[model samples]
Target chain A: AQSVTQLDSHVSVSEGTPVLLRCNYSSSYSPSLFWYVQHPNKGLQLLLKYTSAATLVKGINGFEAEFKKSETSFHLTKPSAHMSDAAEYFCVVSDDRAAGNKLTFGGGTRVLVKP
Target chain B: SQTIHQWPATLVQPVGSPLSLECTVEGTSNPNLYWYRQAAGRGLQLLFYSVGIGQISSEVPQNLSASRPQDRQFILSSKKLLLSDSGFYLCAWVPTYQETQYFGPGTRLLVL
Candidate 1:
């Protein structure tokens, strides 16, 4: 079984300031982790993923996440927050037992960017 | 560029009414297709996935059924829909391996 827990249900940050969204996971296998963003009335978009690669993974829109194996965590971060960054963020874990890569998503965190 | 489309950005149906939602992907062949439902302020719940035409894998047990008549076309249907069937439905696709899955705009279904 694989599961993800987003530490924050909501996060607020001032524009131009740094942003951090925390996530923790539990998986029997090595685990593949992912972060996705969903703007209002839009579908989810992939931000980054950790698939047994380097600890630090860079993604689109000036975002990145560090996969800390020892901590069982993958936290998303950005140096500067933009107004456009206001959206819902989800952390995901894949169950290796499922062949089609069945994903288990976090409840999601709503990010509010204050200007 | 590959793109996926789901019909009727929004829908309102009565209970026990037959339901049909279609999804199609362009610029790709034999791609993996998936259908997911999202509750209000919650994560996605995968319903069905298809790897090829006429082959569908169900992830959840519900009145919903899926069909893949074409290599890139997937459809979700039910003989009758329940009031609990209403939610935001999304269709997605991925090439293979751990490639990122791309989602459609999503269909907001409200059953009354």
Candidate 2:
């Protein structure tokens, strides 16, 4: 069984400041982790993914995440937050061994970037 | 360069009405398709998945069903709409050999 937990329900960051969204996962097998961003009324967009090749993965729009095995975490980060970065972010996990390669998503963290 | 498409960007239906939302993928063959629903302030819920034509697997038990009539086409349908079904619906496709799933612009459904 595999699952993900996004520690924060909401995060507020000022424009030009750093941003961090925490996520933790539990899986019996090697897990594939991903971060997705969703703007209002828009579909979820893949930001980055960790497939056991790299611990630090960079994504579009200056977003990146680090996979910490000992911590069992894949937390998203950005050096500087922009007003346009305000959106809902989800942490997802998938076990390749699972049927259909089903993905399990976290509750999501709503980011509010203020200028 | 595969792309996914979903029709009826927004819809408003009366309770008990029928529903049909279509999704298609281009530039790829034998892709795995999926349907997901996101309620307000909630994460995505996987509803159905199809590995090939005429093959579908449903994840949740609800008033919804999915079908794949073509190799690149997947459809979500319901005989009757429920108030609880109002949410953002997303369609996604993943390559047979890859784990990353690409999503299409979602359909926003509102059942009155």
Candidate 3:
């Protein structure tokens, strides 16, 4: 079984400051992880994915995440936060062994950016 | 490039009414389709998935059902709408051999 846990339900950061959203996962097989962002009334957009290629992955909108195997974590980080960054983020895990490419989603972390 | 489309961007229906939301994919064939619902302030819940025409797998037991009539067409339907069924519904598709799923704009349903 594969599952993901987003440690923070909410994260508040000031514009121009760094932002971090934490996520942890458990999977029996080699897992694929993804980070998606959803703006209000908008569909979820893929930010980045880790498929055992590299530990550090960079994505759109200046977002990046590091996959730490020892910690079982894939935390999203940004050097600077923008007002447009206010949205809900989800961490998802998928086990290739699972049928239908089913994904296990985290509870999600709502980000609030204050200028 | 593949694109997923979900119709009726927003809908308001009375309780006990029938519901039908359509999803279609472009630029892909025999891809896997999925339906997901997101309740307010919550994460997404996988409802149904289709690997091919006439083949569907349901993840959760609810007042909802899904069907795939065509290679690119997937539909979410209900015999009767319930208050609990109201939420944002998302349609997604992935390549047959790929793990990444792309999402549609989504439909907002409100059961009154």
Best by lDDT: 3
Q: Rank the candidates by TM-score, best first.
A: 3, 2, 1
DockQ of each candidate, alpha-carbon based: 0.68, 0.86, 0.90
Candidate 1, pairs of clashing residues? none
What iRMS does model 1 reach?
Answer: 1.5
Interface RMSD, per-candidate values to 1 decimal: 1.5, 0.7, 0.5
Model 1 scores a TM of: 0.95
Chain A only: TM-score of every candidate?
Answer: 0.97, 0.98, 0.98
In model 3, the runs with Cα more than 4 Å from the true position are none
Better-scoring candidate (DockQ), 1 or 3: 3
Worst 10 contiguous positions by lDDT, candidate 2 chain A: A94-103
Global Cα RMSD, each model: 1.4, 0.7, 0.6
For B1-112, candidate 1 gives per-residue lDDT tens digits of 8889999899999999999999999998888899999988778999999888999999889999999999999999999999999999999998756456888999999989
Query: TM per model?
Result: 0.95, 0.98, 0.99
Global Cα lDDT for candidate 1 = 0.91
Tens digit per residue, CA lDDT, model 3, B32-93: 99999999888999999999999999998988999999999999999999999999999999
